[model samples]
Target: MNVELRQVHDSDLPVFYRQMNDPESLRMAAFTPKEPADRDAFDAHWAKIRSSDAVVRTVLADGDVVGNAAVYGVPGEREVTYWVDRAYWGKGIATAALRALVTEVPERPLYARAASDNAGSLRVLEKCGFRTVATASGYANARGAEIEETVLLLEG
Candidate 1:
């Protein structure tokens, strides 16, 4: 599938909300908002990011909105994050989107974090040149418990 990233539009928020709330995706992502179904909070979060200095984009595959990708945080400490519809898993879309995003941002030493058990995400990050640098435990709202998380870095 042809994957591309574009500036996020207001219409894309609904699709992102849906993808973010998928139970399976949520569990795999682990560190998610405390209430994924709360549309108001979701909107608020998006509004905050959209107005920030972050680089956020809508992930389109074959011209359809399939997910989202972004880099956010203070300079030198910025991190990358992405979400792909479950239906498109294992298709290299996340890796492609992330690669494109990093290229666009032109920031080195981008960081990433994923649940230690989320092999798929870890693999995607690895394929995009992110190396595991540390591991830590955090409260996973999705899993409702403290879980191990992997920290990754993509350096210049």
Candidate 2:
């Protein structure tokens, strides 16, 4: 699979919403919005990000949208995040896409977080040179409970 990252287009929101709503994906991505099914909220959130200075991109695999990735937050403390279709999980898409994203935005150190149990995501970050700097707990909307999360940092 040829994984590539490109600017977020106007048409990608719906695909992102659907991918985010997948029951299995949500369970795996525990730290999600309060209401993943709220289209209004979803749209509003996307609008905000797309309009912000964030480096948001649509992850394309061989010309098809398979997921989304981005680096956002305040300078010097920005964070990285990505979501791949469940079907595409473990296919190296996330790792490739994230590597591309960091290459595009070389202003690290970039930070990332993943549910502690999400070994796949942690591995992706690690492969891209991110190191676990800390572990924290946060309320997970999808799981409806607080859970452990790992914090990682990538330094140039």
* Per-residue lDDT of candidate 2, residues 8-48 (tens digit): 88788889999999999999999999999999999999999
Candidate 1 lDDT, 42-130, residue by residue in tens: 99999999999999999999999999999999999999999999999999999999999999998887999999999999999999999
- Compute the lDDT of residue 96 as modeled in candidate 1: 96
Q: Give the C-alpha miss distance for residue 156 in model 1, angstroms.
A: 0.2
> Worst ten-residue run, lDDT, model 2?
5-14
Q: What TM-score does each of the candidates earn?
A: 0.99, 0.98
How many steric clashes does model 1 contain?
Answer: 0
Position 150, candidate 1: lDDT = 98
Candidate 2, 96: how far from true, in Å? 0.4
Q: What are the runs in model 1 whose C-alpha is more than 4 Å off?
A: none
